[model samples]
Target chain A: MARSQSQTVSLADVADAAGVSAQTVSRVVRGSDSVRPETRDKVRAAMDDLGYRPSFAGRSLKAGRYSSIGLVMLNITDTGNMLRLEGITSAAAAEDHAITLMEMAPGETLSLTEASRRMSALPVDGMIFNLNRMVPDFREFKPLPGLDTVIITMLEHPTCSTVDNDQMGCSEMIVSHLLEHGHANVHFISGPELSISGAQREEGYYEALASRGIPAPEVLRGDWTADSGYEAGARLAADPTCTAIYASNDAMAYGVAVAMHDAGKRIPEDVSLVGVDDSLGLFVPHNGLTTVRFDNRQVGLWAFRKVTGTHDMPRGRQHVLIPGTLVKRGTVAAPPSR
Target chain B: MARSQSQTVSLADVADAAGVSAQTVSRVVRGSDSVRPETRDKVRAAMDDLGYRPSFAGRSLKAGRYSSIGLVMLNITDTGNMLRLEGITSAAAAEDHAITLMEMAPGETLSLTEASRRMSALPVDGMIFNLNRMVPDFREFKPLPGLDTVIITMLEHPTCSTVDNDQMGCSEMIVSHLLEHGHANVHFISGPELSISGAQREEGYYEALASRGIPAPEVLRGDWTADSGYEAGARLAADPTCTAIYASNDAMAYGVAVAMHDAGKRIPEDVSLVGVDDSLGLFVPHNGLTTVRFDNRQVGLWAFRKVTGTHDMPRGRQHVLIPGTLVKRGTVAAPPSR
Candidate 1:
């Protein structure tokens, strides 16, 4: 009754008012079934009288579980990243857990020690690393002492679970499709160097061409943006011999399409184009962009499950790669006669 | 040294091992400068020996500050929502705070009581409601007892700070621009009925038309997706008198464009088209879409600041509206002579 307006009422205050022990008050707060109905009612009334608000931190500290998952993303602006987030969030919600989103500053790369330190300070039971950047060495990257971690990367860690789309296979499928269309040589618009998926995709591009006895053209690097794709496309458009192109992602492919249009080149008629991630469908109605369709949301969902230890792989660390399907739209065609 | 692998090492164990008080060990774990260097080092060494990991929950319980901000979004898949998320995350990173993201399941509506209950249970100091749903009555929608709240909605509450784009102004700007293009009538594609921004934009459309002494056409309803826009566009395309069209958002406009193209009507030749949110720039290159451009990121940044009580308006609750600029592309032109 003598409490100041700014002062926070604690469990002790409610206990004192209810004539109950602090443990009993805590049990009531946690909604434990052990407490008698009368005692629970008394504590609830006292809590209302004291205007006591329960603290999740206090509850978590006692239970040793935060009921929250830490999501470390490199960036959220990317469509792929957003889709993954949607999947992760949906999974988390289904499991009655909250997602703590932590994004690295635009170009910040975290060392293992730094990542460990940061993750240890979070009030979360587990962490999901949705950062697209490649981990240089899994041997050097040890998991945090007490935190469960799931990395969304191409590289598999000895002690951590990994979730990723079949980056290499996606590129291989695209390249094979282009080759089937009778293109003599296919140029690739690669993603950023720091990206593990990008590197794997480029490797697949090389393997596909090498297998077919066709030498791959020099890669045009794009930063997974429409602008970057446009610049790469402009250079490719000038080369009359460059008949087919596989952009690493859809946004860049869209940029390439625009660049081709500007240079008076028709899609498929003059040069064929294909991209990964069938995301352009949402933005462009009847876009006819031939792309590799993989569920990024499934990757997020799997990553969340792995982090929470709710996944089927209970014994050993597993690397789950969701496969991509090549969706043939109007972009691919046989190379034009010289 | 005798501890089992399953047993957690508490502050008491560290204190006993270091021959110090539990409070001293706690101070060391919290990195408090109040502890002596030698004692701190001893406690830390004991913690290392016992494999003790500092619990953020314990720290938050003692400090009564979670150092987190809860972000409640209606959905995360929308382009507008994604942009806002980018802004909020960037701002949170700058402020050294993590974001707890909680999204309502698709088509799920939250009553004020339910919203308050959820907010009260989160381990966060404040909350940012990025839910775009309209609050039927602000009087009935009370802020959670002890949490700081900032809502992203058109309606303002007495106790809560609000952040929004100039929704009404955006529609007015679009309508006036279409009128200036010498169009007798401009048809509108409205967003979902539950959307606060959508309702305001509809009001602005009516106001703009009424002031100009031009009768407005029947509103075509859309759910903010490209697919829905296509459905609405098909209906408008069949009507010969529907010369000018304005979509509430860009995705719908893109759908409308595709529909018009399918109907063998050239954009700005047979029917002029315009949209809100210049989001198509990132997806489509050479897409001459006349639109209103507003920074959803700014709305996010402002909302974070408001929730944190770090905004410019310190004395009273305020509604912060980020203005939209009318961006002219090639979508609008004089109507074709009948």
Candidate 2:
């Protein structure tokens, strides 16, 4: 959706809402010392309510340089985000651009209005809003917020500038590899339902089945953890129809492998399997898992460049899709039925 | 090494060497504007040569409230560092502090003098330096460099306020648990020798063995990856003299499990095992990983709190040691011979 020319709110409107002087809000926006914490918080809340957007001219005149970039995420508990940030920040550092990482809870946060106010106050150049699960439809960190933003995620929201590994593509490649190896009707074990990546990957699994003219069997659900994978695998192993299985990530794949072994199914001979993220985990020869591999670090590198506009950005919303390839090891092969 | 009063380098000397004005050098140290990139570089290089220490007066006068906390990681690629930072940054967000993460290569960076110059120039209110490996013995981020700093690492030097997990105590608890269960001649797998956490855990291992009057068996080393664990396990399994195994991390523990399985030895039933850091790897089961479970997240929380001096920093040099308990699982038990 295009920005509404008429609906763009001003800093004065936010100043009016907060019952504070416009100068105080301006000081907060420019990161000046003249404002108090209580005043800043109040202005932030008001800006969010008013959908107040900072114009580049106004921001630049007050703050010397809007050269810093923001890398926003919902959760920091996952190593994936940290690793991705490593790649991005290192790249940013190499270019002498300071990165400001902002951790925000999507949807669960105190309304989009309030969130926008706080986000607008930060003096930054551009941003990378990473949505591990949920995210907004556009780069509106809050309404009418004007800044060049790139979203780093698996979600295929075509309207935004994003740089991430192709989760949907990885899913297709995973299933096709198994099907090509003579496995029929592949079993699917997925990550948490709330994840946008998980949903897209699931969709890819079904689409691949349809493309191959093979009927999709019942899919086992998982929470993207090894524990959840084990639970799902236990159920899959009990059924005779299950010949091959695919877990969304390597952790879950490990769980499924153990469950299959416990159930007395010889890998590939009885049940072929595949996983995502050819993690450092699969180097264990006993559980040498065959899966898809992609460099998330490279995704991070591209993300930094795109967000910073270090060079010319690719045209048309700019979704830089990194591909994941099937890494054939001991896990995938023809089913016994073949 | 103590600073010699007469031998101490002056700011004027540094300025002369860098071919910059004294005021220009001072501006760079305080991170003020009006300094050119080329001039800043020159000043930094000159300061590095003279071992110049920046002044604190200007910095102290400027910093009122901590807007950002600096996090200096030994290596960004280390997954433990990643997880620890995630905890630290998340906790920091709640406290209304922005994170400035610096991926520094202390050894490879410009001379320590220049390194000092670069760091002194960075204007962070407080900092968390996670020294995983053997780093410069500066004792501080150049020893206070004019701000509140907490070294959240396995630093042995008696300098800045240190806050680290009680790994030494945790290891003993784990070893005692294994020994009490009747395992004798326990084999140990360690992480990189450079890590203080690894060294502390090793110290605990040796102490437990020494007190119990058991001969110290040969040590196998790992880089804390699952693959290294497999290699270490293979070496141990090849030696029929070895029985119970303890790895530095869960990933390596899982590696050892795989190696033992391949070596025709059963887990617990044949070669009992234990690990530290409870990092639920792809192969390590929750109950099967009879390892020390410590709240590694607290290290970050404490570091963040201390750096911000949030609520008076509690008191003392504050060497916090979190207790680690064994999650009695299937991995550890008595040796078959016992």
Candidate 3:
């Protein structure tokens, strides 16, 4: 590759232009609190004038660290995963780190050996796994002996940092809200069978029902897709006893909403609906589906911090839980009188 | 920084295990088409058994190409951008390439000087810019002097390859559909004021109206968001004469749909609606809004090929336009009785 070598400016050049020492320039670039505002401004001005871009390549070489992170993600056409990617990217940029992405197709698992091989090949200081399904044996894949690794999952790997939303709490909130809306029976629409989050959410649903002394209803399984939700909705819509339903995610909620519409049933009128993740608001502002808002961005951000050793967390394998908030939209209402 | 060397397996081990020469093992690892299937299978089996991973660091040293590409994208919370990223990632993986992402904050521009500096620093052999808005003077930034570069946009720049969906053609097909559905004037809900796609869409809207001898309605501006769409939809709902609306993208269209629903105006019954991009189907499954579908994945794939120098083209500032298809659903209809 014939790269342009014309605009390369060193820290010394910026320091010379700003009438400061190279150490002072480095301190300013590093955003040290000790640097006076006047000196910082001067350094910035000099950088702007000379178009000095701090090269991570040179810095990493000196520091003996790659200053790069690897994100291993499952291949899915989910907007949620993308949002997380955006979060990780932005956070990495803020910390002056780069990302090397390794994506695998759905159902294709990166074996322990494969991950180990990739870790040695990639010149990254840390790794984050943005997987849809929780890997039970993730702890076994110790790619680098002391490499900081973070996993975005519900299950807590005993030897790896975990960043995840409080799935059980989110599920409880949705179910509790539906019960408060005067719905006698709140049927549950769960995610995939083996999904750790799905299992946690179902447990939360049971806990909500158990606390209220209401018997747990049968759970409907969905693959976290609108089509699956639609299929479940069709089945539930046909059952007259099914009034309020709580879906695992917003995509499935949209599917349920569609199936109800196709069945000539009005939302919140015939069957009140609630879903986890307010992403529905982004995609279907018109649906007004009541949902729980969990920021996947926060999950991504925390994962980045864990891998980069920035967060003031415990040294051992840690689990960071992001709380979910209830976003009351138009979808939930008091159940219709029989 | 402590890396484990215990699990490292050399190529000689795999060659010895497979009863093949080290050169034959290398050819199989490189995915050379010349290697016999039976020999390739034997080497692959040996690799799987021994857990031998080929290090790109060593391979690239001999190949003289870093099998990595940089994707510079605008930082925004758009699902469409994520979808395009997924496309690019999957395509890159197929070709055994890694992606280094460089995301600038929303409303922040990657200046010519900054891009040039980053290009020289990044270890990528090529780069792809996945930008939302058309850069007015994109030609000014020539980052890599001789490295392959691809831009996903409608605007043509000399000395760079451009891959994009035909914005005007997509808009025209949508507008013509509304006009054919008996809409006297097709009102356009335009994107941001400075958007290149917005400008192109608005032009296509005007062209459709002009061809039918009907004056184009005043354009309603949006920031490519649902809230902006909702505001425009609210304003249009107040006007009894406004029958058909063409939103530049699906998010805005969703916002418009919500506003119409809130105002008790039935979609396609009181006012017809059409939007670009079938992403509306994901969020507003029940609304069933008519839209145009453009394969952004194809754009990502082609961009990757252009950067890797795999595409067979006559070089020099190529413009590859992806075609769009009209997806007619429930939202579009003839204008209400006068």
Candidate 4:
């Protein structure tokens, strides 16, 4: 049975039971400096007997700061995104700050007003927004008043603090390395159409080929999954002109590798491959797929520092890039002699 | 430059500018029915001019309930855990309850008192604890007073509402299916030792073996990673006696599959394989691996319903188990004739 209203413990009831005034009970509950130790203990015991629960909302209202930060993301299931979150959480822990994660539904975009309402309602000193995709409408990305926010995306906004990967540079390195291997006809399996990294990498591919006087080959778009890569690979395998393939990410590269294997083409023997963002390195050390590597953790750490630092001393907008490196595993080789 | 004290907005400033009492300003900020439309508009405009930001903490203290719910987890990187979380967030959204995610450091455990204190400090109506591992000390698992709590683990505790998958039943189905296919000996790749689901599944495996009058074979342990599974597979590949293997989860199974492939062992033709969970289905079609499938989404949805329902009704403890089904694919087959 539910407890009756009279049985519900209140500050006045605790005061009456402890033989103290309501103001004294309130001071005890709030842990005020003026309460005597003996009186505090007596009040606390009386409150415990009556099951008096102090509201965190009240205490946090008085404290004004929770020493916590909110990380708002569209999705956490993505490995790259999750790794970045791991970096942020680890860095936040080092700084004695806790993380409050808010995730959007799959493929759902929240309106600016809703986002503002949620951020305002959160008991966090600052917030970090990890928008994997570009906001179509500029106004939708506006910040909530009084909340310090940092954006983590591939794009650099003029009026916000951002920590992101050098995608254009990373893409250029991948394309240059592939071209240096004498692969004139390099087919590209790009990420989803709306992806900022995809567009940058595609531009890099075109720039490399154009600089070398090689015409841009057909580009197959993938939805950042291995299955999409495999489908693209199947289409490329039928074309002998596609002697090499550059996949946007490692998962897609793995899919392409599988498709090539099923099509009776051996890696580095019949077709060479390259990929970006080597999260696959975690599960498979001898994966033998060449790819670009970057410290996503550093990006996250930098973002945390920027958000928390700005929370203390509000600063002007700044943009920082965490660079990428080429990890040459055995997946790259000179184009097969045809 | 940081905003000065004079620039910092307060409720009193809004009240004074609007020519209303502090209580009226508070009501307007809280969107209370007591505030007339004209007064609310005046207060809101005054707040805008004075840049007064309403304190969610203060408003929540007066309301005695925060619309948000806390989801406390040990790790958010695990795919299964993340999928379950996806289920929870989706369900919570439908019910208009926002979620605040609290993740413990990777592989870190907090004491009961610490966990209680953290939950108490959060402005959440209730909390869901998704502890993947079983607590060694019973006292450590005790629920916090005055906070409605739900657990998402296989253990059936007396004081908590729990939503869990039937691990033992799922394991039994996998073992029974493999044995029915005329495999005389089935090696097992078990999950981490401390995992509650892992322990339950191992027990089911032994139960199936004993029921068939077959002695239990050597059980290889993995830390629930594909890399660990690869190491285990490498060890088992050398043992010709090992014909069939049941991996604890799909990622580990995928690793074993890769190891066997590298070792020139044909799946089903040389060694039959089975895995638990079908997260791989997310990426691949026609995966050719036989396994058990359960709606982790359902477990998450059920947990959210239980938590929110209890929040309203303030009910007693309830235990729920979502069952699993065996998905027949090509991976399981009769052992190759010597």
Give the best candidate by lDDT.
1
Proportion of native contacts present in model 3: 0.44
True-vs-predicted CA distance for residue B199, candidate 2, Å? 2.2
RMSD of candidate 3 to the true fold?
A: 6.8
Overall local distance difference test of candidate 2: 0.71
Output the worst ten-in-a-row residue range by lDDT, candidate 4 chain B.
B1-10
lDDT of 4 by residue, B24-50 (tens): 987887679987898899888888777
Clashing pairs in 2: A48-A113, B48-B113, B48-B114
Candidate 1 positional error at B154, Å = 1.5
List candidate 4 stretches off by more than 4 Å.
A1-54, A106-109, A180-182, A208-215, A281-287, A310-314, B1-53, B106-109, B138-140, B234-243, B262-264, B281-287, B310-314
| Candidate 3 lDDT over residue span A1-338, tens digit each | 22234545789988998999999999998889999999999898987777676654456545556678888887546666777787898899888888888786665665643654565466577788876765545767654554578888887776778888898888788888888888997988999997777889899999989988999878899988898999999999999899999999888988998788888898878899988877754533354779888888888888888889875856778888888899888888899997
| Candidate whose TM-score is highest | 1
Error of 3 at A72 (Å): 1.0
Can you write out model 2's per-residue Cα lDDT over B1-338, one digit (the tens) per residue? Answer: 22223343557777887787788888887688788888888888876666565422222223333266767765676556666676777777788767766666444652323333333334356667777665554553344334556776665445467777788887788788878888767788998887788888999889989988988898888988888988998898898877788898888888888788788888887888888876674444345677777666777788888767785777555666656667776787678874
The DockQ figures for the candidates are: 0.47, 0.11, 0.31, 0.39
Name the candidate, 2 or 3, with the larger DockQ value: 3
Q: What's the distance in Å from true for residue A128, model 4?
A: 1.9
lDDT of 4: 0.77
Question: What does candidate 2's lDDT look like per residue over A1-338, in tens digits?
Answer: 22233343567777887888778887787789878889899898886566454553344334444456666777766656766777887787677666666667433553333443344345455667666766443433432224566777765444557778887788889888888888767899988888877888899999988987888898888988888888888899998988889898888888888788788887878888888877746443364789888777788888888767676756456767888778888987788863
- Candidate 4 structure, TM-score to reference: 0.85
